[model samples]
Target: MTKTKIAATSDVSADKVLKSSANGQSVLVAKVGDQYCAIANKCPHLGLPLAKGKYENGVITCPFHGSKFELCSGKNVEWVESFAGIPLPGAAKKLMAMGKTPTDVASFTVTQEGEDLFIEA
Candidate 1:
């Protein structure tokens, strides 16, 4: 595994997420409590950049399709629950998903060295 420096601890607070690149792929680094979690910056549903999404309680919500993913485990919390900004029903959500299965986002292990954060990629 390659350890890549992503950001500084002082730059990311408990409520914020920082976007960085590691192994030539965009990654979103979030601080949850005192732990730092790294997740793929792309949304599973539409491949949209997750950095523009909302991060709350360790979950990131996709801005385009409203898909939610857990930061630490890369688990899919909610999948395709909405479109654009409108809430979709069960049938509508399924249709909007376009046959794409609910998938977990890719997560990486983050290590802190002094004031810098690193990810194993």
Candidate 2:
């Protein structure tokens, strides 16, 4: 495993997700409550960056397809429920998903020592 320095403690907040990289792998780190969590910046559904996605209560919603993921655990909460900020009906949502199944985003180990945060990639 490679330990990579991603950000300072002050660089992340509960309301924000910081986009960084570890060993050339794009990563998104967020401060949830008192812990720092790291996950792949790319959304599994469409391979889009999650930096601009909406984050709240440890969940990050994809800005493109409205897929919601648990930031800390990388769990897929909801998949392809909407398009471009507009809600989709059941049939439309499934159609828009294009037969893609729910997949969890990759999570990394985040170590915070004092003011520096490192990710294991």
Candidate 3:
């Protein structure tokens, strides 16, 4: 695995979101409390950039199709709720029918060295 530094620790704030470039790809980084999380920038639904999406309470919702993901695990938040009989949209239903997995969204490992943040490719 290759690690690339993307930003400074001070660049990110608590409960704030930011986007950076590493390993020739865009990455979404969020600082929640004292922890930092990094994930692939693109949403799997329509290839919309997750860095451009809205982040709240550890959840990142896709702006295009509203496909939500857990920032920490890079897992689809909708799936967990849907399995409990939560009402999902028609588009999401179709995506599930098409066998779209949460793993479709790429994710990376994050590390902080001093004041700099690094992401693994």
lDDT of 2 at 39: 90
In model 2, how many backbone clashes occur? 0
Cα lDDT for residue 74, candidate 2: 95
Model 3: what TM-score?
0.77
For residues 8-107, what per-residue lDDT tens digits would candidate 3 score against the true structure?
A: 9888866757888887888888776677778888877657686655679978877655667877668787531232235467676675435655444676
Assess each prediction's global lDDT (C-alpha) against the native: 0.89, 0.90, 0.71
Q: How accurate is candidate 1 locally (lDDT)?
A: 0.89
* Residue 27 miss distance in model 3 (angstroms): 0.3
Better of 1 and 3 by TM-score: 1
TM-score of 1: 0.95
Candidate scoring better on lDDT of 1 and 3: 1
Candidate 2 residue lDDT tens string, 32-110: 8888998999999879988798988999999999999888899999999889889999999999888889999999878
The residue pairs found clashing in candidate 2 are: none
TM-score for each model: 0.95, 0.95, 0.77
> Worst ten-residue run, lDDT, model 3?
78-87
Residue pairs clashing in model 1 are: none
**After superposition, candidate 3 runs with Cα above 4 Å error:** 79-104
